[model samples]
Structures are given as C-alpha cells and as structure tokens.
Target: MKQSKKIAFVAGVASLALLATGCSSSSTAATGAEGSDATLTFMSTEPKSITPQKEPGSQIGMALCANLMEVNSQSQKLEPLAAKSVTSQDAKVWDIELQDGWTFHDGTPVTAHSFAEAWNATATGSNAWQGNGTFVSFKGYEELNPTDGSKASTEKLSGVEVVDETRLRVTLNAPNADFPKLLSTNPTCPMPESAFEDLDAYEQSPVSNGPYKFISWDHNQQVVLEKWDGFKGAEGFSGGADKLVGKIYTAVDAAYTDMTAGNLDMIRNVPATMVDKAKNQLGEQALYEVETASKQQTLQIPEYVEELKSPALRRAISLSIDREAIAASLLKGHAQTSDSLVPPSLGSYVSGSCADCVFDPERAKKILAEDGGFDGTLIIESNSASDQQLVQALTKQIQDNLGIKVQLKPTLGTELSERRNSQKLDGAVFGLWGWSYMSPDQYLSQYETGGDGNTVTGYSNDKVDKLLRAARAEMDEAKAAKLYTEAEAIIVEDLPAIPLFIPTDYGLQSQCAQLNDVQGDLQYYRAGYGC
Candidate 1:
C-alpha cells in the first residue's frame, strides 16, 4: 500500500518532474568490481518525502528506515529487525527488547528512547504527520489528538514507556493481535531526536537507520545511498550491492530504454505497455513478474451518489464489466482478477468469488432494471495516467455491456484524494487501494465506519464493523481468520467497491542480486548474491 499511498499524493510533486527536461536517454552505470562496488540503480517515480515518521511510506521510505519488525515475503510472517524480540500477553501490554549496536546513519546509537521520542512526535497533531492515525490503538494516544483545534495535548505518549536503553513497554487501548505487524510499518521506524530539529530539511535529506546510508538527494531528480559499514544488519539484511540509487524517469519508455542498456539495474512497477517487450528483451532470467497484494485498481461508487447506492445497482455495475478481457487485452495477462478486497497474500484471505463476481450482462441488466435503472452518466474518476487508461477501458465495457452512460474523468491524485477525504466525490473513482502489510485487518479495518480507506466508497455495515472489531480483538489466529471471512462476505455482498485487479510488479534485475519478497514487494535488500 506504500506505493498506492505514494500515488495518492504524487500529484503535488509530479508536476515538477513533468516540467523538467528528461534525463539522458541512456546513462552509464557505476562500473566496479563485485560486492560493495556493484551498485544497483533503480528508475521509479520520485517519493514526495522521505521523512521517517511523517512522509507517506514508499520504496524511498523503506530504503531509509529499518522498522522494528520486518515481514518475510514468502511466509508473510514477522521477523525481528531493530527489536530483537517482542512479547505481548492479552494482546495489549507488550514488551520490546532492542538488539544492541544498531546505529543511525549519522553514527548515533539507536535506543528505546529514540523510538519513543519519534513515535510520540509523529503521533502529535501539531506535526501534521499522516502516520498519527496508525497509533490510535496505543493507550492514551487519544491525548495526541486533541478534540479541540489546538496542538496535541502532550508530546509524551502515556502508552510508550522506555524502561531502559534496550527495553521498552507499550500499552494499547484495545487488544490487537496484529500490533507487532503494525510496528513493521515505516511510520513506526525510529528516528534520532535530531530529525525534529528541522523537519523540512530533514525530510529532503534524511538520515537512515537501514543497511544503506543516505549520500545525496537531488530534489526532483535522484537519491543516492551507499552501504554503511557500521550498519549492523549484515547478519540479516541486504545483499552484495554496496550502493543503491533511485532516479526519476520522466517517461516509462525512457526507463525501459535505460533498463535495456543496463543503466538501471532495475525498474519497479513496469509499465503495462512494456511488460511483454521487457520479458522478451531482458530474457526470462532478468524479467520478474512478482505478484503483489496491492488492489491496483478498483471501481468505487460513493454512497453520496444516490443513484448508484442501491446494492442491486452496484452489483449490476460490477457484473457488467468483463475483468478477464481487461486483464488479457489491456494488461497483457500480467494482472490477476481480484474477487475480494483483501489480496490473497495473507493467511486469512478468501477469494470472495460468488455469483456476485461473475460477468453476466443479462443478469446485470435485469438487476439494474429491477432497481429502477439509471438515466444519468456515471462519472468515473482516474487519479493517474495509468489509472486513466484503466478507467477508459472500464468506461467502454460498462457502457457497452450495461447500456449505462459512463463518463471518464481524469484528475490529479491529490485533488481526487482531497475530494475523497472530504466526502465530496460522487459517482465512481477507479484508483489505487492496497495493503501495506500482511494482515486482513489492513483491508477489513478500512471498511469500518469512517475509516480512512473507506473514503472512496463511504461504505458502512454494522455487521462488517462488528466483525472487524472482533477480529482485531481476537488473540487466536484461527478465530481472527474466521471473523475476517465473515466480514469479507458482508462487504462483497454490499458491493460498494468492485475489485478489478490484484497488482503485479514487473522488473528486470541483474543476477548480481536476487529479488526477495518482503511483505508482497520484491525488494533488493532480500536479494541473494549471484551476478
């Protein structure tokens, strides 16, 4: 979901990159011997901010902050990182023990106080950090959000107690089985106290506590990181690469060209247009079609759009579109048709496939007619150029099959996000929605009443809300899975948002390092040495 979150806010800074001239069509890769000398250059969209606690989590954020815990891509289980071990009973009171000798890029020792200070600052309202919402489960975290329009009540979180340099205790407001998984997020990554000294400057050129240290950040251009010899993650993190460089490509075609020329060691989220060609050009060894838990694109109908609020109408709309055709022709068979809101990466995931997900134009027409069929154009909003393509394809299919007038409206991601958050958007919006971690709660909780992820659909179901709450409080994994299954059933029945495709990541990587799945993302850190 970090990629989706990044896309949701990219409109604010995309214009800058769009305005600037493109980089050299083909650049030279840093040539040197193997190991640390072997640098990996990546071409991706620029991250809006890299501030550890405040910025939207993205690949850039992941590169900079080593979280308290890390998720194994293959197993979808938690692995200790900064915190050597975490123990919790009753799913509320948790004790964390940090691994000794980890240090910030600036050579400052990381401690329990570092995390406590960072999380408290991030949870405060005055900082305007988007991550504050993630910590609402912590006890006394409510104080960080003053009911009044004043600054946060306190900088010190009553929930977080630093017992000593290596030990800390956390108390949550409610029992949450996924609390440890939550700590794996970038927002929860600890930052040195000095990060607060100049938040703005720090965001542009932040120090990291990860395997790589920040070297330079050329705004709107590129970010450079080099292996930190002092980094203690050698035992469990990173591969043979000594340096990692992330650069912005004004055009995907340019990125593809650079990847072919070996200027870029890899390029994530490969453009659909180039997926097939990339596979052929890079050969099977280099091309990777990594499956992700991202709900890449979804068709959302807000409750405010009165005409489309009927459950029957929503189902009709969902059934009218041919998802398989879209995946085959438009996506070039690189996409997975998603029948459920939660991706199939988590242990509790269900396909949610039923008569509701099947494509049947006649049945759809009958449902819509019975529901007193529409007379107006359905306005579908697209947040990005890629999304606009998908929206355009959907509009054609929905209009052709349902005989409903569909209008494709393109808008900047930021503007659309604003409209969504304020509950001002009507009709439908086809955009990004995904999970950042491997938990059903990440997807189910969003459907809770007034949840941030529910912005597009404005969906509310008492059964779903109650089931999600029960799942969150459930200490047993099996019980939680059952609760999630029940909640998912309720949501798919409501049909507020129609799942389109489970996102896929396509990239070309040299054998120098193998790609490892980390929480559904195939990242370089987990790569094994080869080339």
Candidate 2:
C-alpha cells in the first residue's frame, strides 16, 4: 500500500498476508551453526507469493530486496535507498535522483527506468494489489474513455518517464503531494532487469535486491533468505547490519517448541499458549509487550448504488456482536474493542459515531426487525480461524437476536481476502480488515467512492467521498485531521460498518526478541528480530 499519503494502513494489512501463509534461518556461531542463534524464526498462517505489487512484494520488501526508496520507522519518513533523493516540486511531478553504487542480486546496475517499468507493469488488476494500492492512482495508467474496458489497464504507464540513468520524472492526473512516500512499499522496491527474462515469471519468484536474497520456499513448510552483498543502503539500515536470516512456520506450537529447545534464537511473536512455560524456561530472554493489534474486525457492507443501502442494517449487525464475549473467549482479554473505524491509539479518533458503535444485540434485533431488508438467504462471512469460529459466532448471535438463520462458511485466508476484494460477496462476508494507526493512507482512500481497498463494507456515501477527498487534499496537518474527524462522524452515522475488538498478534517469541514498526502489522513473519 502507499506509505503515508493514502494507503499506509492498507500496506500494513497487505504486509501481514504472510501471517496466514507463514520463514527459515541459519544458526550463528554465537548461538550455533544451525542459524538458530543467528536467524529469526517466523510464523505465518498463509503462504506468501512473489509479486512485488502484491502484499509481501510491496512494502518493507527492501529488508529482503532494495528499492529506490525506504520508509524510516522511527521518523515515519521515506528516504532513498536505490535513489539518492526524491523531491516533489509540485503536486503532480517528482524529481528522483538515483543512488550511485546500486546493483541487483545478479550484479546488474540499478537504473531509473527499472523502477519506472516495474511500477508501470504492476499498476492494475491483481498486480495492483501487490503494491498495496499505490500506483493504482497514476495518471499514465488511467485509461480515460477506453472503449473496450470500463477501467484503465496498467499495461503501459504513460506518466512515469526515464529522464536518465540517475534521474526519473513522474506526472499525475490528480495532485498527489505524497507520491514519494507511497512508493516505499516492497513491490515498488526496484529490481535488476536481469531477474526477469519474462516479467510474469519474475512476479512469481523474484530475486532480492535489498540486504537479503530469496533462498527457497516450501509453502506450508519453510521459507528462507540469504544476504545480498550488492544492496545499496543509507539511513534505513541499522548501521549497515549484516545480512538477515529468516525462517517461517505455520504453527505457533512448532515454532515455540523449537525456540525453547534453543534451536531458534529470534522471533517477534512469543507463543501465547505456552507463554507461561516459556517464561519460566527462558526468563529475561522472554520479553513481554503491551503491543497494539493492527487487525480490525468490521462487518462489511456492499457499496450498492441504491436500493439495499442499509445503514440501519449495518448498525444492527454492528450492534449484534457480543464484543465482550469475543474478547473473553476468542481473544482471551488480549483484544481491545475498537470505538471507531480507526483505532484511538493514533492519539485521535477519526469517527464521531461513538454513540452507536458498540455492542447492543437487543437493539440490533429491533433495528433489523424494523429496518433491515433481509432477502431470505442466510448471510455469512469468514476468516482464518478454527472452523469458522468468528462466522459461527456471528451467525449464532444474529440468529438468536434477530431470528435470521445465517449459513456460515469458513475459508482459507487468501480466499477470504479475495472475497472482500471482489465485492461480489454474495450476502456478505464475515472478517477483519487490518489498518495502520501510525499512518493516514489507510483511512483516506480506504472508504472513498472508488477505493478498492475501501471494500471493507459495501456501504459508501457521496458525502463521505467528499470528506475523503477534502482530507487528502488538505496540506495543513491539523486541518486535514479535523476534516477526517468530521468525515468519520458522518461515516459512523452511515453505519457502513460497526467497530469490533482490535485483537493482538499472539505469536510465541524469545523474551529478548523485539519486533515492531511493521506499521502495527501482526504476522509479519519475515520481519527480523534478535535476542
């Protein structure tokens, strides 16, 4: 997703896709030759794919590969990695000066056109998903008045130009003052032209250009990366740190088991089921954190043009959730019930809908009885939990309260993500959409009129669109935040979704390990950590 301008939180969500897919490391001599001491053991629920434009591909991809730029976690700032610097003189144009001694894994020198070509190729359709909604807004990719397709094809971008090997130029249809920050995701991380004899194949298994290179991945089994000495670095690196070693596992139990045996040295997530035992076992090596959960469980509404636009229904659904029950049973008190679409930890609330954004099963029943337009078939949604736990729980609550029998269905994580994106979600899907509290991009375009990432709910409003555009356009920090607050109030009234608990990322880790700054993302298994 875009870094800060409009897709930051969405990028956090995309980067976490591997949490569902599930990393490998070598043992250091300080620890052993197994790479356990030297490597970080990571776990992801879903398998990762190799598309720069895709979730794992776009943001933070530089940890494994290099891009033209990188985002600094401490400052929430974007800086050049492959490029020397990027400056936007105006809203539509940016001047990027390339770094001097950059090279790909294959030793091909980095070029301005490589970045431009990569952005151009992955700007539409599925590839667009890779970049976390970044270049989807580029002017060259916009197919205005195309006779064949309704939307523009990202086939050949017309806006980005290769001025020279060191400098590149870009033009936008709309004024995007935050363009540089948006390109900080992994997919936008530049690659050497040498890695791709065929662009499609390269998308499947990309070679790294960052501090690390892809070693091997066995899907549900293991994934690995080795250091790339060719990487060009600057401010983003931890003082030119040595190459990172990563390992991913599917089950927390397996990961925890290995780490406790001293076979694993670093992991961001400490296994919760055995946290007590591990705490006794590893002692101070077992670090504890009151971390924030990036995932937000919201009821999705269709962006129906008319007819079935039901805020009341959305409200009723929101009210039906027994958040207390979910927190007590599923989350085990590790989750915080959200009061707004955007979490409050950002030291601010975006929505003014705090009045009805809460648990009220009885009220939900009453609202549905009076206002819901139920079409007979039981509506259900799902995610990557134990046998549709969330779906089943939601169905039981909705039925017990409203007398509507919803047929719940469970699905794989990737499939569930796809259902939301396609928006043809039959009767509605039950799941969560993760957002970043530290960055603003996730909120701005996420719920806009045409925002693909905004599909969290089918519901959208014209006035809401006006609010989004206003917020995005405002350069004054306070004024833009104020606009967002007002817009949030309008959305709360609209009830496209009801806020649910913000759950924590409960992964098992060694006590001394620390992993943060993945944009509040959980399940960023590939993220490196140390004892």
Candidate 3:
C-alpha cells in the first residue's frame, strides 16, 4: 500500500495545474547548535504528537519527548541510550537494565515497570492498538524462540516477567533478532504511564521524557514546546541550559516574514518555488538549504484493489507516470525521478527503474486490452490539491492514450486513511508519504500480507514472507540486508503497486536558523538550528 500522502502540495488545485520554480543564490545560515543556542523554531506538516489519525511532523514529538533505546545517527554503530544493555539469556527471556538515573518530564524516575506496562499494552494489542507495535504483537513472545517447531501466539507472556524495579526481562517465543531493533523504533519506546488515564488528553497534552517537554498545543495556531532541562542524556541538559523551544506554523510565508523581520528564528520546508525571493529577502547569514533525503511520493496500490487489481495493469499504470517531466516542470527540478518505491538512502534493492516509469499510452492500452478492458469507471483518492490536478492530468493522459474511463476522487488525512484502512474506497492518488525510517523492513511490515498495519494493497508472496521472516529472525545485518535484497526482487517483478516520483521537502523560514540536509521520515517538527 502507498503509505505516502501529499500534504506538501504547492497550493490549492488549479494553482497546482502550473507549478514552477526560479533560481536563487546559495545563501547560508546557522543550521543547528552552532553557538550553543538553547531554543529553536521548527516547521512541520503535522503536530508533534501521535493520535488516532494522520499527522505529519509528529515524529518530532517522538524524538524530543523521549530518546529511543537506540538512535542510528552515531558513527560507532547503533547507539544505545536508555538501556544499558539488552541480551536474551535464552530464546524467550531478555534481560534489560536502565541507565544510571532517568526521569520523565514530571520528574518521575523511570523504572522497569514503566517500560513493562507500556510494552504490555503495545505488544498485547489489548488497548486501541495505536498501530504502534503490531509486529511484535502478531508474532508474540513465541516468535522469538527458536525451539524446535513452535509458532504460537496464544498463552500469556510467562517469560517476559519483571524481576525488580530498574531491571526487566523479556521472553520471546523464538530467536527473533528484530526484537531489539524493534524496541529501538516503536514497540519499545516507553509510553507515558499517564497516557492511558485519558487518550483524548494524551493526544492534545502529551508528557515527554525526551529532550523537550510540552508547553502547549493549540490547534489552528502554532504549537509550542520548551526543552526539558532535566533531560539527562542530551547536551543542553549537561550545560544546565533552558529546554529547547519549538513552535509549528502552517504558513511558511508568515513564518519567513517573521524571521526576516526578526520576530521569529527558524523554519524548515523552505518553499523552493520562490527560492530567489527567499534568498534575497532572508540574506546569506539567515538562509540555509540542502538536498533532503530522496523520498518518493508513489501510488500504494491496495492489495484488494478493486478496479486496478491486475499486476499487468499496475505495471502499465507505472508506465503512464512521467516522473522526470513532473519533477522538472512542477517540482522545479528540485528532485530526481524514481521508478522503485525504495529510495537510494539504504540498499541495492533500489532499482533505477526510471525507464520503466516512462509515459507510454500504447503500452497501457495493450495491458488494458489483454486484461479485457472494463467499461466501468476508475476512482483515485488524494489529499493534496496538487495531487488532484496531477491525477486529473494522468487521467486525461490515460483516457486520451487509451479509451479508458477514469475519475479523480481526491480526499486525504483522516478520511483518506480510514477509507484506505477500512477498505471503504477503491483507489486514491496517494503521494508525498512514506515511513520516517530508512529501512526496507519498515516497508515490509506496512504492506505485506498479514502485516498488522497493511492497508494500501494486500500484497503477498511466499518468498517475501519467507524472506521477511528470515530477515527478522537473523541478528546479523549482512544477512538481513541480503534477505531484504532478495525480497525486493520479488516486489519489483510482482509490481503490486506503481512507483510515482521522489519528491523534495519544501518550507519557508524566518531568517534566524538554517539547517543542513533534511530528509528521512519525521512525524511533524522540522529539525535544524535555532537562533
């Protein structure tokens, strides 16, 4: 399924019908932490907290609220933070220890029980299933044990019992290698013991244990957060500096105006369409830019896709997409064309399949003919107004090239996600969406058959299943990459969905703080330096 969406549209529809960009000088600004700056302003597509529905920029909430067990940005390898160490005494039981002394924003000392209760709620799927830790829940503790021929999900977690405060144990059903890594991301991220008291308040008022604390989150206005001085692990805490200050604003021009006028300090997603204007107004000392992560806005063909279900049809549809032209004309040559769903940040599995993603009306016609062209209409769902324009453009192309009837049904955010997840709709022009992480396994768990979070299309293959299983079970990175590599071949050949285009991140900032390379998946807040 296409997990990507298009909230990054340039403007409302009709306006997007003709998007263009202009050249600008390469001005630079202070990115992040250049002068021990304590506070920063961030730009984002969503709030900084997690909720039932979709929100961009919420990943910042996860990062700033609490440090994961591990963050991958370190050069020495996977950097472990909160957990001193993690080792499975046996296939089922894993022992863990807390760092010297860690406390939540409320000054409550973190103990084993904090993680235990959170893990229990996430792994058991007993609660509303925040859609956080479905993988661990589906497999259960048994998925960790390599004992003979045992694969069961029933029965309680007899092995993952707590020994005492500050120390904990885990019991897996099999020798699942992904257990630790999984903890580093989602299932293991400690939840506020206070979150469950009221889910509604939790969404609006989140308490964090990361580098920052919640100041306020007022919808229809900027959300502000101040850094947590008590944060034990971050650099600012060691220096006794005030916690970082974060604010989110929807309008870049306003934010940029404030920045240049010296009312605001920083922003992300610098709108590239008006690059020349941005550079001149902001000046070199206040402007910053970088080629963000190569992320794609692709079509996630739902597994049970009603009308465009055929692999041949999906492949042909891929042919109808003109990524380079779209990138050049609309995106202002800010990004590259991509034919494969996986971007170039990770592995060899990424195939430079641009040639296949070319516009070919004849080929699409052939495939439709072979599949027995249906007279019924086809619908597309999307959120960004620009996507609707693009979808309409593509629809026109398809209809003109091949006598097929098509329709554009654009919708997004909660409505779009519910339809996609509940199977209430047939198709949508999903774009500008993807996982925040750079791992292929992230994609697998999102779309593969039986994947707890799978929505776009229920793609399944015995080989991919086996490969995913093997990759998850193997502790070795080399082995894991190999398995994913093989799995990718299957995905490419199967063509369950169509690869759209790799899109660039855009935003406007007031000229206070500039940043280097912004890419990868983020929940909502943009990360860079502040003045």
State residue 243's C-alpha deviation in candidate 3, in Å.
Answer: 6.6
- Quote model 2's TM-score: 0.79
lDDT of 2 at 175: 61
1-531 in candidate 1: lDDT tens per residue?
Answer: 222111011111222432363321111122244323667777755555666565544666777778877664433456677777777756778888898888898989999998998888877867767576677778877788776777766778899999999989999877777877788787788888788798777777788698677888886588887766776542334444567778776555777787777777776666565677877888888877665555456777788888778889889888998888888888887777877777777667776543477688999999999988989988887766344566788899899999999888876554566676556886788866656676788877767774536655778999888888788888767888989988888888887888878757666776554566655566655444444
On lDDT, who's better, 2 or 3? Answer: 2
Clash pairs (backbone) in predicted model 1: 511-531
lDDT of each: 0.71, 0.57, 0.54
Q: Tens digit of lDDT per residue, candidate 2, span 292-372?
A: 555666665565524336777777767777777776665556567777877665433644345766678788778877884
TM-score per candidate, in order?
A: 0.85, 0.79, 0.76
Residue ranges of candidate 3 with Cα displaced over 4 Å: 1-39, 44-57, 72-77, 88-94, 124-126, 137-159, 171-178, 236-294, 350-356, 385-403, 505-509, 516-530
* Model 1 poorest 10 in a row by lDDT: 3-12
Between prediction 1 and prediction 3, the one with superior lDDT is 1
Scored by lDDT, model 3 comes in at 0.54
lDDT of 3 at 377: 69
The TM-score of predicted model 1 comes to: 0.85
Top-scoring candidate (lDDT): 1
Candidates, ranked, TM-score: 1, 2, 3
Output the TM-score of candidate 3: 0.76
